[model samples]
Target: MVKTLSRANYPDLPFYPERMIQFGEGNFMRAFVEWQLQQMNKQGLFKGSTVLIKPRNQGMGPRLDQQDYLYTVLINGIMQQQLVNDREIITSVSRLINPYTQYDDFLRLAENDELEFITSNTTEAGIAYDPDDRLDNGPQKSFPGKLTALLYRRFELGKKGFTIIPCELIDRNGEKLKEIVCCFAHEWNLGESFLKWLDEDNIFCCSLVDRIVPGYPHDKATELEQELGYEDKYMVMAEPFLLWVIEGPEWLKERLPLAKAGLNVRVTQDMTPYRERKVHLLNGPHTAMVPLGLLAGLETVEEVMTDPSFSRFVNLLIENELIPMLDLASEELRSYASAVQERFNNPSIRHELTSIFLNSISKFKTRLLPVMQRYHQEKGQWPELMTLSFAALLLSYRGDRLQRQDSPEVLAIFDEAWSDQGTVAQSILSNSNLWGEDLTQLPGLVESLEANLRQLEVVGSRAALEHRIGVM
Candidate 1:
């Protein structure tokens, strides 16, 4: 008989007070943050549960609660060149509170005395300023607005503010989150006392989270359930290699004890180096690969990694070109880049190229644009491979070849660029509004992009990619 996963079935299971409130109870949070906390619990370094608050209504809080907040995380990858397939039921999440359905409950949670740390992974799009959201509404639609109301409640209760750590892929996510919340305060005309409390009480820490949680193992469900002897609705799958770099003070280590728990978590004053490594090496490559790879006639990340032409193209771009532009040591950079390649090639996980293509224009601005600029600054020439990727992006928007999920404003710009504009490549490049600066003004960037775009259009991305390598 398959016994249910709950403390009711196995009473020896230990439960703790809710000390942390995490937003966005998605797969990454489930497999990475929540699983890490479970480890911290096992080591007796921390004895605290998490109160989950989803960023939006389209979440699984109610479903998670149905099973007593019990779910399994399957860590899949190659460890020491050996296949590692491990699954553990995570019980760190005490309950999932949907702020939309139970706004009062969500607001009341702010007054919890033990809650000191707040973490969120609302994806790239969740953290934003929605002007229409009013303070008096049942639940402010945006994450930042919802957070501001929660913080206001805490301030009213005289509760010390939380250490807000955002795992959003954006740079300085913590700082950006705080900025949005402050914007909310000003927009809503919340109060002076509230403003002062926010300034003095809260701590916003930036972070970089690198983990490929392919989410539900839908394909291997039957095999997994038969193996585990119980059905888990919220089973998340991820690679074994996980890293969380939190930009925080010396006190954070004392509080979380993740380092003591033997987890790959770093608490430092600045997480910029780690962030850069992830953004430039892992994320930047992904952004470049998606449009080009899709056009190259590849489906999954593993496909691109396995393909000799596409794989070699990315490795050269990262190692030979992009790495020299960074301030980090070559050894560390090489190791990170190598690890990324390994993860990309993981046989167990199939990372769809289209999934990574969401908000691609926004992704390029953050992930690849800076590297392109720095490379131009250092080498005084266009980074040809990176330029090829940019050309792929512009060419993608020129037609319906690649499906884009960028913001409406961004889509509008690209729509116009691809339309009646004769010199569309140079025209789009001149829009500092899009690329953060006039990319056309960069020496040889526009010319190089135009050349590559023309080549790619004529011969397709795969052939162009191979031809570029051959010419090099």
Candidate 2:
């Protein structure tokens, strides 16, 4: 009979003191951060466990507690051109506390003198200000609110401050979280001393985290259980490639010994290049690939990256068209782009194209637009592949082929682009408020997008891409 994965099944394993309070207990944290902590513990560079704060009442806390906060992380991806498929049980987390249910327990974690660091990945929308959140509530609805309450408790108990790192996808994630926390300090009337303590005591590190964690291998769980001889409901699947670049004081390098473990963590003075690399190379491709891949009948990133024509098109776009404009080293850009390709080809994680298609308009603006404009200005010619991708972006906004998740303003803009009977392409390109410039002024860009759109309608995304392979 298969048994549940818990300490009762394996009694010899050691548990360390909980030193880190992770605000979000999701797959990304377990697979990415805690996995590294497990490695750090083995090397004696770090001997600390994690206290979990379930961001939402998502109901995973009770299940996690039953298993002694243990879960397996399956790593599947390429390393040195070799396919690696591996699994390990992560025991670096000691307790799971739901602020929604165990608010007192959550607040009590602040009393532990060993609590040194805080990490969070509460999704892109979680780190925001809600003026309605009051300090008196058992648990505030916002992530920052709960955090402020916990910080206030720490202040009251005269505890040491924490080093906070937020893994939200926003630019300057740590700075933004601190901004909202300070906002709460003022709104909640937590006193000037508390504000002074927040400013002087805590260290907020702006970080860039890259790992494809396709959480909870539900489809392969039965097979995996038969192989492991234990049932693991919270098992997570992730790529082998990991990069955590955090910008903070140089002293953090001494405190966090993740680098001593020979892992991919970097405590740096500047996180700008790493941030740009992620947005332009990794995220840019994803945003550009969404409509193109989805309309081409591709289901996942693995399929798109392995298909001959599609694969070549993406490689060419990043290497030749995108990175030429970036200020970072060409060799570094190539290396990062190569890793991105390996990540996309990881078979275990099914990175759905539709998921990346959410908020494509703003994503395109942030990831691809700047590169496209810079390439044009510097080289005196429009970059063809990304321009074509722009065509895909505009066409994708119609909400026809892929599942659409965008603001109504974005939807209405696309509606106007499609509804304009005179010149759909010109109408969009001339809207300076949207694109920040009249794209029609660029030589052949308007014509290029117009032609690509026509080809997409006539021959479909695959055939259009196949034909364009011979052009650029």
Candidate No. with top TM-score: 2
lDDT by residue for model 1 (103-134), tens: 99999998789999899988899888898998
Model 1 whole-model lDDT (C-alpha atoms)? 0.86
lDDT of 1 at 167: 91
lDDT of candidate 2 at residue 283, scale 0 to 100:
93
Q: In candidate 2, what residue range of length 10 has the lowest lDDT sum? A: 395-404
The residue pairs found clashing in candidate 1 are none
Per-prediction TM-score: 0.88, 0.94
Off by more than 4 A, model 1: 100-104, 130-141, 183-193, 400-424, 431-433, 457-460, 470-472
Tell me the alpha-carbon RMSD of every candidate.
Answer: 3.1, 2.1
- Please identify model 2 stretches exceeding 4 Å from their true place: 398-405, 432-444, 454-460
Q: In lDDT terms, how accurate is model 2?
A: 0.86
